[model samples]
Target: MIDPLIVLLIGFSVIGLGILLVAHLFFMDTVQKTRRGMAACAALTLLLVGLQLQHLQHLSSGADLLNSGPYAFMLCAVPAAFYLFSRDVLLPDVPLRLRDLLHLAPVLAAAFLPPNWVAVMSFVVGAGYSVWLARLVYGMRRNVGRFRFEMFFFGLFALIAVGVLALVIALPWTGAPLFYRAYAAAIGVSVALVISVLLIYPQILTDIHEAARLAYANSTLKGVDVEGRLEALNSLMTRDKLYCNENLSLALLAEAMNLSAHQLSELINSRFGVSFPRYIRELRVAEAKAILSRDQRSSALSVGMMCGFGSQSAFYAAFREVTGESPAAFRKKQPTA
Candidate 1:
């Protein structure tokens, strides 16, 4: 019989698949949104599936080692995903390749190991890698400026707490059950959920909570009176098709609004609570959807170029940053009208 948690994992499979499908649908037309975090979520779901399978297979490997293997892969997935999500939500200038390389570390390592060493190596690497992610996340909080990644921090703390529990269970003074390792497996599932919460609908949530607080406090602060320019900004956003420009910015939007860059930026910060680039991405993503829907023969369209991207690479990065799906993958998932 399936355990309660396993039942939930099955449920998660359905939910994750649904999310991935929806994410793909929105992303295909917006060919240039962020999918790094989405990819991480999908990968984590797969990780969970693999773990469930391992449980059913009743493999003779050490429980600790077996449990840890999938987790190690997960360790890479979360941080890389976090990096992608945060970069999209916070910093546009950061390179996607940089974040991507970090996530692939485990797969890279696998090439060097003999088959028998895979289990122990996965456990050791997974446990150690998660610690590295926690430390890195703390550093990101400290260094990445004021718009912090609260989601990654949440997951990091939970993982750290779990690690402490695992250590406690392993202690000679502690009479840990041989089955206690399963407790840690549960943490693996929790980690995925936290990442999902932060990535999906983050812009909407972020807009509601911290935009006001973040607006006036930083060096990037736009200003206090934003409502005055909002109509103009909205007009420009709708009429000018600014999103079609690959390099849209606060200065540009401000220029169009007949306000100084400083004033315009302040207005966006005050009104929208997001930096200009992020605002541009959100708009661009919305536009992508319109274009995709309006044109039935989407194959005739170049998804990346049509979205105001200077290049496919730039569009792909922006798309993943915005919508959490790759262009091709998203298109494949779209429902036929």
Candidate 2:
């Protein structure tokens, strides 16, 4: 028999996570669909925990109660809710259409089917959604940057979703009552980890919102003169020496060129085939090389600072990344006057 204290602790933790997620809906500055999807996920989690607590208490027919139609629907809906949340968070511009509801048809079907069939259907849906979620995360790997921390937490949630489904399906085969308790405990822990991270770094959600908006803009903009924009961007960096600003940012540069940050980011990624940071680093390294060749007496650190590198370490790293040699070594190779 599972300890009553452990069940209570897990139940309260899941309830706390649900409360936090709901609170986030109000606290978030924007009214995005992602918030609603997250709330749905939290509700499902709470329901699942409640069902598990009932089972642990050994109330008459408690296991049967958990296997009932409503419980099966909630079990199946959790992954679907997570998928919806992930889609909204990662691809906000993609409208949720009627076809998306088809993903939940299995849950509805499970409600009418045998209890064993419900478990089978839920596993299939959860496993497929987990793979899809993983692919979405992989695609965003290049652009996520500091947002990868949030991605890691979401990945944990996805893994837990799959593990829970597997444990449910394999429970009959293994005849291991302990696996059910383990599944409930895992869900509680996963929710706690996600909620704690988000509360600590709420900016992650804001960053994701901005990134999704930028991605949407980049995809939809059309009829614009790519060549002209490229020329303007080059002029800003080469002639105006915007790259020489240590505090330069995509948004700042975009504002100077009368473009959106997304537009500028897309231009750099498509035209230069590099991210904004890499483009700036290349420009700074090129300037540093010119200074090194022209003035052999100048220290590498001085040239690095003048060229807009924020630190000597960053200067050397970027220099070596571009030139395959340290700045000091590259300077040494230059001929004396």
Off by over 4 Å in 2: 30-62, 147-155, 176-179, 209-337
lDDT of each: 0.51, 0.68
Cα lDDT of candidate 2 equals 0.68
Residue 125 of model 1, lDDT score: 49
lDDT, residue 167, candidate 1: 50
Task: List candidate 1 segments past 4 Å from native.
Answer: 17-21, 24-32, 35-45, 52-92, 97-103, 111-161, 164-267, 270-337
Query: Can you write out model 2's per-residue Cα lDDT over 1-337, one digit (the tens) per residue?
Result: 5456557656667577667666666655432455556666566556566645644554333365445566667766766776776677667667778898897787678768876667667777777877876665556555544446656776787777677667767767854354556656776677678667655444355445544454444453376678888898888877889899887877789899888766777777666655566678889999999999999877888898999987787788778767889988888888888
Model 2: residue 265 alpha-carbon error in angstroms: 7.0
Residue 172 shift from truth in candidate 1, angstroms: 10
Candidate of highest TM-score = 2
Which tens-of-lDDT digit does each residue in 72-178 have in candidate 1? 35433444444444444433334566555665565556555543344334445455545654454454342222325554555665565556445544545443333
RMSD of each: 12.6, 8.4
